[model samples]
Target: MAIKDTSETVDNKLEDKELDKTDLASVTNGAILGRDLTPEEDRRILRKANLHLLPIMAFAYLFQFLDKTALSYTAILGLREDLHLKGEEYGWASAIYYFGYLVATYPIAGVLLVRFPIAKVIAITMFIWGAILMFTALCRNAKDLLTTRFFLGMAETAIAPGLSMIVAMWYKRSEQPLRQGAWFLGNTSAGILGGLVSYGFGHLHLLWGFDDSCFHHGSNLSPRHVRDDRFLTKDGRAQAVARVETNMTGIKNDKWKREQVMEALCDPNAWLLAVAYLASIIPNNGLLTGLGFSVLKTLLINILPSVFQLVFVLISVIGSTYLPNTRLLFMALNVVVSIVGAVMVREVDPVHKWTRVMGCALGVAFTANFPMTMAMVSSNFAGFTKKTTVSAMVFIAYCAGNIIGPHLFFPSEAPGYKSGFLAVMICLAISAVLCIVLRFYLILENKKRDDAGDAIEVPLEGINLSDKTDREIPQFRYIY
Candidate 1:
């Protein structure tokens, strides 16, 4: 055989190591299954990881959204009448939850991840919020409602940031957009589920044998009620009503302590992400929070209410799931949709105008920005501690936008929320510019690393980072 240089042998070994690192595992017998792996193999792995991870995160967010937006659905029933709420009382009730969320978000991100397991913390928080949501039915007055909403906010503050941290731990930068899109599709799904649940709950008072008073209409009375009725000299209906009220005040115990969520607040990256989140989320909240409901209400007059809601849900689902390049695409789409929708508001007697407006709003406002923001924060930060901190900061900004959203629902802009829509359009434009800038910044950072000869090294399985000398491995650069 011809003699090969030692240098050539060393280069061949390095190439072999890289190739081994890039192969996928086989299902049976724990073997390396694939052959001749390429860049496309790396992409496939990323896509599979995203597919597995995004659905889990999306389902988690679906429950979070249900817990958060349950109030909006509840408001459609007799809650306002029963609670005797006044002007802006509903808005305040909705906004106050975000205030509680804001107070807790950073703390959860910075401190909690360091102290507790992520899954445990997230599950506990989810259970707490779910309990809070179930308790909302028991709220007797505006004060009680506000208190409940505030606590609900507090319980939910951990989920968004915590999930972002999880994503960062598992994924690379280029893999974020599609994963983020999948997660945000949950929001769209939540809308559909919320509307259906709301419509069903709204009709609960009409269930079989139930009177308009939401009581079973049997003349027969129980022994306890009958006994109480004799003393009051009337039927036992009032006593039965009292018993129902007592039974409905479900469990009200606090599941998580303040100290448990303190880690999320301590990071610098959290603050940076918060700035980005604030820029992106303000307009999103403005359009989706109150404007969506208002548009639905107005369009019910000319359009079939079912058609309008169906269209809204469909648009939201498709826009959220399908959008590529989540950060830039969502922001750009939002601005264009808002401007077009606003202009369309002036169209007299256009068929399905409400549907058009809703489709645009769902595409622009409700879909992509949320997921992208979370993904961006996750991609930028690393380790559980720093990731949690950044995630919390992003959500804190999200809370600010939530607070600001309802304020845009001015009484003066009733029927047609022109000013609010226009304002959101401007905000969307600003966010689009910021996203582009951030993209460029990331690109520059990656380029600098490449220039320094620090490109990512693909390590073989069981290779330890500590064992690999700097000269032996290429640097892993972040994707912009």
Candidate 2:
């Protein structure tokens, strides 16, 4: 009988040393996964790896945001009147999706994500959600729409946390921010593309002159339409594992550890990140999802804030790359900008419509905190189970924030939702304070660890060979 390592392998993969056959096997099988893969060869192969990996993530995230926010567009287009939604009913519709998201995220991460092939889980969920999105266009009433949307949120609950885990799996720590940025650019990309798509949906017609079906068809077709063929098979997979061994990125923590779970739960900084997420999502999701009800024109509503958001996301991601210890700094600056925008929204004259638009856009721009915070998650934690637990915890905060966010913009607060904007500013302020405290905690911990033999950065091979959690490693420095 084959050993479990070989017996359980889905692709029947062979190690690099085992592939020390002829030169033809190395050439035909893969580029990076061969034996004794060199650094220069690794760099060459990384380009190929990114090509295979990044676009798949970017596309999924792009459409996920687009589909998730499609209801906001539909709100302005006539979803409420058609469905006979009264008062805060639409807010409930918006908020309910996150409830399903909250319920499903942890179980899925613990069970499906931890126990199965990640790429397969991601792809299957994308397909499942795509099908759910199609059912959205067929809903006849609030109940039907809510049913489809709640399931949609449940399926999508896997992507963000799953993507974060995959990022750690594939890239080195330093490469993570930019790669995450590139995929996360899909957020702003969704803003720009989704806004334009939504605008087009409202104004234009397609397929025998029925325009509304476009959203239904578009959401379904877009995901299923583009198939990612990068997943390897047979010996190709063996070569990929060779490349992975070069990074030692696949060290397993398969056995359950009660202590790891306890450590994750007890950490104060974990609570701080969760609180920050809870507070931040309230305002950001409120502004992002329900902005249609404001005085802004539909075209501008779709486009302008996204323009600001796109620029800021790009800037912050790039800035984080060059500026050391600047994640908290950029987060603080975003909060300042958001607070100013809130003040602008409150104090500005009603007649100056664009000024108010600018204020809202500035407020929405604070979404850069998302990528920054997630980067914090990936860089700060280690070990499979612990990191998954942290991701589940933070996203629960995410679901709570989003669930509460919509309700803050009641029908009573129409046109100028003073209370809504004020609440967001307060949330941003709270998040900013949390960022500082988290940074300070990280700094203090690094100082305490410095006395041990943790000075120089150790190779991934060293770390992975031991399968040490960040908590277990004396030298594991938390990235700010």
Candidate 3:
């Protein structure tokens, strides 16, 4: 397919006729734009757009997560020993990144989204974080690791919100779940990817110059081979490692300034969605940061370790993406899984570990919420400004959750983080309630509009929700 610039396409359409600014308002809802195409054509447009958009957002998130989580894997490989990190220092370093993320997330959503081209903004941020990830290999201690993580968080703050804004601009309400699911699958994919990468790195530690004390291939090998081994210089090997790392730094582009991005923050719906996102995010981040440690320290010793973690990651990705009635069902299932996981953590049996893993996997179901909410906001809001504002708000909530999640990991609850599990359970339960409330609210609003004779016919034309000047089609009610 031809890669046509969307902005240029819009410009060409405008030049074809003396553009009617007023007419733009008339079709803000499904009214006029819906009328312009047949149902099949409309489906085709939305489907194609989603197919293109979701993968981009998902992959962007996948790499963003890989960079963020790399620290955890590194820590397992003597990052702490190498850097002289102390107890709770790892927790603090991990938590600090979210602080940077939280500070930047709302600002980008509220300001930069309006003034900048999202694609350019996101691409630039991605490149910056990738560079930071590569630099992390050079860190000598906790302080350096913390600083790099903070900057990494800052660079990634644009991703969830920016992608939400972009998705909103393209798809309607009914089509949101699957598209959103696709984007959220990035998180699940990250879990699987992180594990695999860590496993590879752990294995690499046994090679010629890579051996760290935690992993020694020589000790496991035949005595003759162990004695014969004469390793290369650490400094020489480190230089080669540095060179390889530097080459992995990704691309960079121009960034949008603060003022230009804030326009998306002003919408009220943005705030509502942010609140909803916060409801889910608290548990999600908490689980992600600690789950690996829990599996390694507790479960890996007793079970077929690969099967346990692999199952959790697989269930998370598949259940979230392909589950029926994704929005409500997934949230409901997450609540059950979290509660069970929390309960199982306190048990003594090996089967209990499986329960905890299942609970963790269920947490993955929350991924559906991100995409669904984005689609809802996009379809309901009119005009570029309003849409962008709400998009920013959604991300602000995402950042809030990330910040709140890690704090639940208290030192008092180490080994088996009982308190954090309970806290996450509460978060997931709250998400379920919110989903129900939003669903009913949309239903009532639709009914009221239908009664008022302002109901929009499907296959509408020219109407968009963001266009405020357009006549209110009384039937146009907000879909829950």
The lDDT per prediction is 0.49, 0.65, 0.51
Q: How well does candidate 2 match the true structure in TM-score terms?
A: 0.81
Cα lDDT tens digits, model 2, 267-289, are 87678877876776677564433
Best by lDDT: 2
Q: What is the C-alpha lDDT profile of model 1 across 342-415, one tens digit per residue?
A: 45543323354555455444334433456656665555543333345456666777888778866665667654
Comparing 1 with 2 on lDDT, the higher-scoring candidate is 2
lDDT of 2: 0.65
Regions of model 1 farther than 4 Å from truth: 1-56, 203-273, 285-335, 342-356, 359-366, 454-476
lDDT of 3 at 106: 55
For every model shown, what is its TM-score relative to the native structure?
0.64, 0.81, 0.68
Q: lDDT of candidate 3 vs native?
A: 0.51
Top-down lDDT ranking: 2, 3, 1
Question: What local lDDT score does residue 355 receive in model 2, on the 0 to 100 scale?
Answer: 79
Per-residue lDDT over 1-480 for candidate 3, one digit per residue giving the tens place of the 0 to 100 score: 222233443444355332233222222211221122436544545554555456667777666666676666666655678889898798778778887887786566555654555665676666666666666767777888789888878887877766665554444444444555566667656656666656545522122112112112222221111012123133222221222111111011123333323444543444555676688777655433333345344323222322333344345435544553344444445545555554555343434455555555544545545556665555565444445556656666776687778788786776567677677777767866776666565566666666766345421222332233111334344544
Superposition error at 253 for model 1 (Å): 31
Our model 2 lands, by Cα RMSD against the true structure, at 7.0
